[model samples]
Target chain A: MSPSRRHSDPQPTLATVAERAGVSRQTVSNALNNPELLREDTLAKVRAVIAELGYTPNRAARQLRTRSSHMIGLRFEEAQEGTSNATMDRFVHTLVEATARTGHHIVLFAGDPDDPLDGYDELLRATAVDAFVITDTYAGTPAADLLSRVGAPYVTFGRPWDDPSARHPWVDVAGAHGARLATEHLLEVGHARVAWLGWEAASRIGEDRRAGWEAAMAAAGTSTDGLGVRITDNVDAARMAAHELLEDPTVTAFACASDTLGIGVLHALAERGLRPGVDVGVVGFDDSLGAQVTWPGLTSVRQPLEQVAIEIVDLLHTVLSHKTVTEPARMLEPTLVVRRSTLRDSAR
Target chain B: MSPSRRHSDPQPTLATVAERAGVSRQTVSNALNNPELLREDTLAKVRAVIAELGYTPNRAARQLRTRSSHMIGLRFEEAQEGTSNATMDRFVHTLVEATARTGHHIVLFAGDPDDPLDGYDELLRATAVDAFVITDTYAGTPAADLLSRVGAPYVTFGRPWDDPSARHPWVDVAGAHGARLATEHLLEVGHARVAWLGWEAASRIGEDRRAGWEAAMAAAGTSTDGLGVRITDNVDAARMAAHELLEDPTVTAFACASDTLGIGVLHALAERGLRPGVDVGVVGFDDSLGAQVTWPGLTSVRQPLEQVAIEIVDLLHTVLSHKTVTEPARMLEPTLVVRRSTLRDSAR
Candidate 1:
């Protein structure tokens, strides 16, 4: 029972491929890892022999030799258990796509709701994951300190707004700019006294989005007082909040923090027998799939998921390869997608 | 530059813990792997020493010694890129949770839509994933053949309907039973002529869902002739198809193969000013998160995703641990959740 044996016959090894190819073990290694160093004829012969032997570059043995696990760790954090969130799913999808293009594969760890960095220690101890890609950053995220203490190479998707001087590699979307675009678009569409609907939770990203709206309002010389900044994460809660906000007949539009909140705004408007885009304008963020299906089709700011995913992987890869990435905090812009939800007098 | 070094400090090993605990390396191994073999005091002492020394078990060394990667491979197959599927996300969530509890982690491979099993050989050769959890099974999935040829263990989420003689571990939802439940509920609600909206794709699960509707309709002593089974995977296509299906005023209800098709049916109904659960009743399968958000709230059959995920991990773990899982081809029943969409003249 050899380490690589399946049942009766042992799995092929580098030694087997070398022997079959009439080459030295070092030659076989070079053929796989540093093929350019070998002659064309020798490389071709080794590859064919390796293929014939069905030889797989043993990752365990390679890890021992190179001190790299070649595995990327990702934490799947659910805000609410058993509840589906589209943004997180999309992020995961893009991250998987990005990592797959590289040779590295993802090893997902379930983030402990209580500890936040729940599975980090266990993953670091039990698996050979080379680096981690952390998302859902908030104030006092224990993941950063823990990974830093362990000297684990990692990159975060959210900017570390809590610690401005932190030197860790991170990539974030320009959510504030996206919000500004949404607010300005609503204002341009002849909407005065636009309301801002945001999450009740105190998060850096949430603050950024709010700031964008505030800045846009201020620039327009509009009084920011009583702008109807209602806070709610649930659609129904947001809808109820929206109902209260809409009591002021002058508040003609809503700049929602997310598509979910926007959906709530739409529900509230429907309850009042008001049509979106025509009677009351609404704009959402994160252009999630739900945005497209929402009755009037919500106007939203699309997060550049693919680009952000690529940056996360590239930053982590650079750190793992011992190469310096100059821009540790890479901020990318988000695009605004205008749909019928924001158009004035739009058809159903 | 040792294999497990972090910056200037080398990570602690079993020998370090053993020396600190005043015991043999075997004692430390027993403390971690075979803890039950050790005396309580001895086990506690080794564990404390290991923790104090920050000693983590070297998985690569363990892999070389035990020949087990301790990884479960799962393919993230995308039917269409950027299309968020809640069922798959929930499945991944549950799988991660289940495996994390068992000290086994999942290694996700980006499924190739072109070849289906494009990354199979790559994963088998590059990583030490113990077994695969195969899902999204079609009539001729290349994954099964690829894994079998390589002597890899796998358990599928779909029934191996293409080959009944195939003796592979698999667990499938009784989709037909779910369809039966939905159909019977529709009939119970006084809908005489029910239509089935199914995917045009040739899938075992899809067929099972349609068959359930057919079977239920037959058992009711009603002729299923011209039952208006319109098939389309696209939402707009289904909507257009639904328009044609609804031309016959005799059709009083629709049992959809998926929530997407159900959504399309809802859209078509809305366009015609037909209130669901009042003028026409509608029921969807998979009871995805979308079902809850759809207007009037769609009545749908909930696929036991959590249970199914647990079963997948359990069956694969059983096979990997050399334990036989009795009733490998397990068929679990689905539950129908009645919502406003199914209630006649229901209000939001």
Candidate 2:
């Protein structure tokens, strides 16, 4: 049962493939990397030999010879807001899968968030990663500038909000669209007094989500005059704020900025002995893992993590291939997942 | 504000440090790697110049010269059980921090769960990582064997239960000890009919946790006969099994194998209109991020992830330095965190 006792077979090298195919070293190389240069019959013969021998290309050797590692660099930042951080985890999972699907692998690294460029510099000097995919870009972030200064190929998963005209490639989710979907869903379910719960910060992402909520409420022709609007991202703080909101008795539902705040709304309801779906409808953004198993299943907005990963990889590959990205900044839509938290009559 | 329009300074190289320190390139290199060869004043002067010049060593060039990458490889497997997988995430976070503190970095990769060595092979050939820190190893697992056959240095973050005598370095958390703590806590809080919720599998980890609960019950002189010991790791599946357990009405508390299973217990109690802390108490193993946010915060066993991360890095470094590891397989203790979920009279 212990295979450690046996001698291991050496991995098949280019020489082995060349010897098996009865081709010169250059001919085998052409067949593997520059197949179009060879005749159809020769290409077909070399391909058959490679398949029969089960020879895999050596990426490190190729990188050494060509100065390009088929690896993408990703920096895993420490979770600052620890409670609701699944969105980044989901992004990473899809990024790894998507990168692997395209004959590339991700090199995960952690850097000092305060001075992230130091980590990037070290990785660039030590490894053969061809490009990088930067996540969680914010206003005045130095990652894009550092990558540009060093002439390293990279793509950010967040927009360059500090400077829209900056020459960098990025992809971001439309948070405003996600917030509107949540607000509209609550309104459609006959909630007249829909209060907004948002983060108390001058964040671009936070502003986008709040704008969506305001627009949806205005379009519904409802006077949100007495609606309770609490500003704080902490769940406990949101719960405390909700206590005051519940005193009015006119607030029927809450449209939260994220699932973390939505959880707080549920806590407030439980405190007052108010049923979630029956007495109050709560909707949240970023359909995190917490929403799935919550007592009364949360209704939330789900970002297309898979598609976002694919787009980021595709865009990075474009830049690596020396092709201009037509639309440097791409925005994707978020979908709504309706659950028992909003479905009052459906007894599931 | 417009960094894109301004010119940036180039990263400092070894030559820059050497020039600043009024020393030769070889002297600078010796100062950084082998300070004992130089006088104390010379060594201090070189380091001061290096800090001032911001000269970071080139990792790739050093690997080519020395055949060491100073990196530890880690493979991230997709969560098969899906829900309640925060334990692995916490491990990753801590691992990154610990590796960085030792002037080393981690390389994250993904692989097929059924066949993991393929990913390791690919990474070994493509990068210059010195050693690997393997997590989530199981009985009859081939990762250790495959790595051994290739003569690759690695240390697992789990015990080698299938063969305790296997020549390998590992660091593991005492799962049975954690479970025992949880069970003892429940018993101390006046819970006589405390049932156990566990996964329905022959997992070494699962068995370890089960043994702790059994040992605790035996010590208390309580007959655990007909105790609701449902075996399903899935949250919804556990909830279904919990319905039958709750029918007995005498089961006042539960000691779950994991936080994921504990979440299911919470769901089951909510279904029966029973308050978590008031009517019944629930304790979970692995104080995961989910435990902190769940309503009535789950009481759980907190694994020392930071210490575990530190031990793994320290052990791998020892192996890389060709030093003898005193204890090949080290096991660490776990602490129990009491929260509102287990407290009957704590009003939030």
The weakest ten consecutive residues by lDDT in model 1 chain A span: A1-10
Q: In candidate 1, which residue pairs get closer than 3 Å at backbone N, Cα or C atoms, i.e. clash? A: none
The DockQ values of the predictions, listed in order, are 0.45, 0.37
Which sections of candidate 2 miss by over 4 Å? A1-28, A38-61, A80-82, A113-118, A125-128, A226-230, B1-28, B38-57, B80-82, B138-140, B346-348
Show how many residue pairs clash in every candidate, following the order shown: 0, 1
Residue B120 in candidate 1 has what lDDT?
Answer: 68
- Residue lDDT tens for model 1, A1-348: 012334335678889989999999999999988999999999999999877766788888887677778889988765342222466777877788889887888898786677776777766765479889888686655788778877888999888888877899999999999999999999999998889988755767777899899999999999878884657566777688789988889999999888878878887886687878998999999886667655657899999988999999989888988888887889999999998888886544
lDDT of 1: 0.80
lDDT of each residue in B231-334, candidate 2, tens digit only = 76777877776777888888888888888788888989887888887788899888866677778688999999889998998898889898888888889999
Worst 10 residues of 2 chain A by lDDT: A1-10
How do the residues B32-69 of candidate 1 rate in per-residue lDDT, one tens digit apiece?
Answer: 88999999999999988876766778888888778788
Q: Per-residue lDDT tens digits of candidate 2, residues A228-326?
A: 364767678768877778888878888888788888888898888888878899998877777776777788998998899999988988898888888
